[model samples]
Target: MAVASDKTTWTIALVGNPNTGKSTLFGALSGVAQKVGNYPGVTVEKKVGEVVHDGRRWLLVDLPGTYSLAPRSPDEMVTVDVLLGRQSDVAPPDVVVCVASAGNLSRNLYLVGQALELGRPVVVALTMNDLAEAEGTKVDAEGLSRSLGVPVVPIQARRGEGLEALKDAVESAGAAPPPTVPQVFPEPFRNEVDRLADVLNGRQLPRYLIERLLLDVGAHIEDRIGLAEPDRLQLRARIDEARKRLAEVGCKTPDVETTARYAWIARATEGVVTHAGETGSRFADRLDSVLTHKLWGSLILAAVMLLTFSAVFSWATVPMDWIDAGFEALGGLVEGALPEGPVRDLLVGGIIGGVGAVVIFLPQILILIGLLTILEECGYLARAAYLMDRIMVRVGLSGRSFIPLLSSFACAIPGVMATRVIENRRDRLTTILIAPLMSCSARLPVYTLMIGAFIPARAYLGGWLQLQGLTLLAMYLVGVVVAALAALILKRTFLRSATPVFLMEMPAYQWPSPIVVVRRMLDRGWDFLYNAGTIIFAVSVVMWGLLYYPRLSHEDLAPMVADRERAEARLEAAKAANDDAAAADAEDAVAAAENHIAGAQQRQSLLGRAGRLIEPLVKPLGWDWRIGSAALASFPAREVVVSTLGVIFDVGEDVEDEGEGRLSQALQSATWPDSGKPLFTIPVALSVMVFFALCAQCVSTLAVIWRETGSWTWPALSFAYMTALAYVGAFLTYQIGTWLGA
Candidate 1:
């Protein structure tokens, strides 16, 4: 053990069994200084924080919770690395605080026992004291503390109790003398663990190494070690012999040494533990009745999902408007203050417009994550998964896929990374492949803009519903329907296999900690800005250049510029000659007149020439050249379709302008030259909106797909399949509508 020095900061690792409120305790101990980041070379997140306890500032590492030291997944590998000091980036923790849920002492101590075996300073924090007491159960805290050779403090973490005792134990551990005696393991298992340790002599080992040597089930562990073929064969033979010896003595060969550790823990826990009658908590029983009911469960899940989508659109509108207005004002500020040059264009057009395109969508992401975190923390998420499991199973997906799918509603990268939980390799890969097909937060801006611009606001079919709202709802449904259908096709064809079984342990329902919820939302928001925001910015720059440069020689544009300048000069001279009130009246007339002339010139510019060139090809689909160009711009990002239309129609970047104040309205009022019909007719707008809805219009999504799959093959296939689907779907919609005289 290292001595605590004035210059050295002690490292404390928060370790506990699963479902012991360790995360809550970590959040309580280290609040704002905590950072949630990914562990190196893996997507599994690590949280590190600093705390001042007993006049000492300690760095705390919150290790992932596990049932035992036996590593089962990638997340569990993090716990193993930190405990063994094997992670090069993080120092081994100086002290370990094992959080034991009072209601489940025996199981919790199994982890504590294993931690103690590592020969580190260990303190036990007994959490959920109130829950135990409410169930008429009592734990002899002091007696148990004596038996375990450590200090124990009873804590009701949610109510802020016994925090001082926990801190005192940490301080005492920092200055304490090392124990002389080593922990003894029992019988045949002890001998076998020793044999395995001898086999691993002079080599650094994972915490779960001994356990993995016992089970020999998964290939991942042994693969990491690169054990020789002969040595691995000998190890397997020794494990079989050990299992046979244990069976002869009427004992089972434990999967991990920690299993036997827990057996001893159970014996030590006797007499100090008692269970209450009925064996169930009232709150849990009540919640399960409604939340887990087969019929009501599905209905509640549907209602919750519907409400979440509706709230995402309705609630985020005000904040989105404010963000839009702020960007617009900032753009105008730059244009007014800076001299007319590349710097001004860069500020107003390139940087502001490109960044604003992504930033304005932040409110939608925040609201969506907030709602999701509440549902997840409140225990409804598990029940929703249970309800969806039957349908998911039919498509060769486990109930575990539900969370990833739900996460896809926010972003696909996290959703793809989340598939690490599905133990089956085939199922996990399939989930990763299809996750991007589900609509994401990035698609929301496109959906809202298109639906608002194109779909009629008035209700149809005698006020049964607003056609526009239904169209928006239908767009969401299209993604869901396509995703499910794609899963079915993939399962039946390429990734054909048995549907993996879903086995989940549901947690007791409790109110979420507001601090944790807010932290989660902020983490997600920052992740979006840092990850997806950068890609959108770069793509926007390319798209902006594609539409902006190759200027008409200024010689070609000189005629239009000279004409506009002469007209503006005449209007200014007329305003100067008039009286003050008359000049104000003339100002409005001059402004509208100038706007119309500029709008016309833009329509005849190079972009307009290209739109006209492409108009014939798109005319059958109910789009003129301008709509065609907007659709083309939407390839990099669908939301760019909205802003591009604004630019094309000379509606300055103000997003909140409505009531004949938006370019979409100008589009709606404009007529086709040859057809003598409105360009944005009901069928045409719906078809275009539908096209935007289903396409892979996000570069970030494609990038994530590439990163996650570790190949461009899947993303390329995804793009091809989705673009084909979008075009065909839009084509069918347009043709059918025209046939019906829509």
Candidate 2:
């Protein structure tokens, strides 16, 4: 039978606890018919997918996963608001599908009980039946259906089992009258709830929401209704009296709802769920014993992170090389096709170069996201939070902050977005502020380049450890240490708040779904390309204009150009006469003449003048004008610093050529104009790397921070404080190193 009711589409809400396979079912049901956007007025993502079956269309709204509907944060508030139809943008669901894990039925059924209380037609889709069977537990689907007086279907969403039957159950439930589940609360609580329900009924609020407001302390219902101070206080006073009366009857009002809900669930599942004793030491538990141990787990986590970072550098190199060559070839083709002019230079140097600098990091980003997704899908990431909880708590953050900070190692944008899991406002904001100090993949290029050029490749510990790799590792460690210290300082000073208790449910380990991992990687990659890529591209073009503008006069360039041509002519003449030595000499002269002209052009450009102006400020860090200009130009994206240096040194900004050690060679050979001595000494290289490691050079990161925090103040503070720290850090590093004669 159809539940269309003459309408073309029926709205269905999919509700579930976290890690309940709800998203997997949604993906399998909707396939390619899904769209994602933020809920109106909130940054929490809203996913809606459509499925057409049996001449009826169902719009499935996937709500955020939460253990309960009580609102604690903005993100959690969205779940309650949508279920109660308080959100103006979304309609009330015709049928509610409560996805429950068959293995974890009791805890999962707590959410189902709330769903039933919403007075919507409900169908229970039991997922993870196989997991339950494997764990020596069995769920009686028929008994559950009879006990709850609702349709129950055991379905394997990942394996596509019983999906059609589940769909049929949904349509049947949607058309049937809403179920009348008996009230579970005591008589006193019921009276209070009924009284509140009547008042809410007069105001057009749902009975379910009213009951929630009566039960949930500090719920946002008053704010949602825009209750004035007098009425709000009066209603709150009534609720307190009701709660006190309930407490006087030997019932704790604060936890009464939860206790009664679980009691109801136990009765509903009595004789339905069969288990062989307590779940004793499953493989996940056994593994957790080693992986979550204090000493061994910490070491394992460190090793996993080390491997992750190492893979980011080593695995991404091949794809990065391909991207670099592709851009290089494209630039060369454009240079050949177009005549020499501003238009050609703008296309090749400004647009292509700028965009390429950002694009080249895409492979590394994809790899990191893919790996992290695997860790999440297989359920180890939750354990990571568990392992880091003690250390995170010491710094006045919840264990939830650990994931976002860990994610910052890949990129701070996603890392900041990950803070949505943290419900406390101060904890989330503190995490956002310190996230950039985690030293993301953007700093990898700078570290690798500087370390390779300056730090010798000699091995230590009997040739087991390479000095350069250790230096790279040190940079990352420094970032982590600084981030922890910054979090501590902010928690104690500016962003102070009582540390909230951290609670998390660890999902059982399972083989990661390839489809889920790939889909997530694509989502993150597209997000970066669409949002951050545009900003970086525009910034790059602006920097190019700054460096290319106010063209030098022909007379100013004429003498050097003439010298190069004359030297080239001499080389050709010598080659024609078969004079190899003379030809070599002429070639050297030509290269010298070209460098002279390039130097003159760079010094005279607008960017050059600005760099010269800032050089005095940076001289204490042992930087010359070129170094200062490159550093300034890299503000939009840190990877551009290498390309900017290539350009500044008269070498073409080709990623492939730069990787071939040309940029390093140029830096090594660079000398101060006034002193004519080497400029890029060991101390200077260390200073530069240290600065990049600590500086807030990424506009994309700042944009994401602003978006996540809903203000410019945090982003501005992040930029200012990081930049100041970088400057001081580099200044002390260089000054101290110079004094030590290193």
Candidate 3:
């Protein structure tokens, strides 16, 4: 390895397998001081944090977790390229710190073995030692260090234990000579690698990387190296000859390397590690008996999901209400302080109302994310995935895909971000395409409103279930079913590929640290607010402008003003006569007249015209121009539908008072202009709910999809397919319901 000569400021690369507490160590070492950005050409997160210890400064780069240096995906390719010093943006690390789990030593060391081949000084930070002791496994750190020819430090990153020692060890490695570990390959294979390396004619490539290129079939290193056409053909011929000779010697290229590496590791750890003989079941194994049970585990997973959703709805209700009222009071203050003009209107409607609509959902978002973090930290998420693997595999996905899809229940943006854990590109892309169909929390408001207004409060199963609650649950299930079918279809057609192997390590269950969970929640919340929230805010402003522009002139309200004047005069006359009933009737008439004028003005706005233009297309689904207008306004956010309907119905866009029946009352009492028949029936309400449940209404979801995929093609395809499915689903429901009633 080419180490930095100056060594004033060392660059240390932290590498490890997933779930080894590598991130926890990074956090403990760096605290809150870090910078996050995307890699130069890939969307994978690149985190660089600083560590100042003992008057020495270290720049630590936390690389993505990978099982091996073989580049199967862009994420792994980045990890390999950076460690190989091929990435131009980053300097090669002065020393490598491989964090390993004491409990899963053998598997963790597989990665460490690969790191040793990179020629950099390697230091092992062994974690989870306490858990290993509990499982009757003892690792002698000194002996293991001697065997591996490196310094090993035991650390409990969560508690900030052994971090100082780890730092010292890292510093020591930086000052030492670069390790020259010989290859573990058999003589025949080593000879083949030597021949291949010699063919390159003194190229600047490292010997280990050249060996990797020969072993990793169809690796990207060939493309990255930029070899001439003639040299590439010659290199290919040499690699084929090497493999043929190795096969004649009763050895396979890839399998032989894996066997040789493991054999060497076994010999190195033979006397250094000791295990209790055939002990009784440990806590994890015992817990897995029930948690990973096929039938009971599925039920447990369902109950967990139910509890999470229930908490999001129940616990967040109070905070959501508080936020709504606060914004409403602010809007009222703006109205009361300013005169009746366009400036006041824009502040009240565009800024406060539009922004508040998105902000009110923050409580639910935080609650959902916080709960998921706790579950993940406690390691129950892995068991949940294991339980769902059987079902997911049928749809061309592994158990790993379930976590991301489940996260979609809270929001599709984070769900898309969570797909980075899936190593296979085809699986990850397929998951991203269908994630939004999981019916996120944004659709909850629309679902609750429609069901409350239409579905009766009758109970079933001895009051254990209510008809309205069942309808809400059924809407969520519909999304789940549709998303599964869509995934199967996509895998079978558009993104078809062989199913990659799925292997997940189940860490021992432990109590999650509040600090860690809270930090993670805050990180995700900030990411959402920064990346997706900006797009939501901009879209909200555009929608507000569309609804606010083309204001009706004072002359246009002359007739309604005269009608209000007549009602007021009647009210005054009745009051003077002390006729309470007559005065009440006159008051109602005045309010109705004012509401009519407001609705008329809204109908003349730009958004209103666009809604009318699309009314014909939506008419078959039992939606009138007003409902269409609300739907169109909610394109930026699903929860905006309630506020949009309130605005269109002249209810003042404050729909938080559901008990007072403001927006629902308006919808129920509404009538068609031509037939004078009630517009919102049970069938119409069900159709609208179905459409919202399946439609791609949230622009935040689309933005995240674009960011994750690094292209617009997938997001565009997602929007098109989902919107089409929603229309068709709603159309069929409306037509069938109307026919049944007839």
Error of 1 at 633 (Å): 5.7
Candidate 2 per-residue lDDT over residues 162-251, each given as its tens digit = 899999998888877788866878777888788777665657877776777777776566777778899888878877887788788866
Question: Cα lDDT for residue 454, model 2?
Answer: 83
TM-scores, all candidates, are 0.82, 0.90, 0.89
Give the distance in Å from residue 305's predicted Cα in candidate 1 to where it truly belongs. Answer: 1.8
Clashing pairs in 3: none
Go through the candidates in order and give each one's C-alpha lDDT.
Answer: 0.71, 0.81, 0.80
The order of the candidates by TM-score, greatest first, is 2, 3, 1
By lDDT, highest first, what's the ranking? 2, 3, 1
The 10-residue segment of model 3 with minimum total lDDT is 651-660
Model 3: how large is the Cα RMSD against the reference? 3.5
Off by over 4 Å in 2: 1-4, 277-280, 441-473, 528-533, 634-689, 698-712, 732-742
Error of 1 at 346 (Å): 5.5
> By TM-score, how accurate is candidate 1?
0.82
- Tens digit per residue, CA lDDT, model 3, 27-55: 98898999988788767778899998667
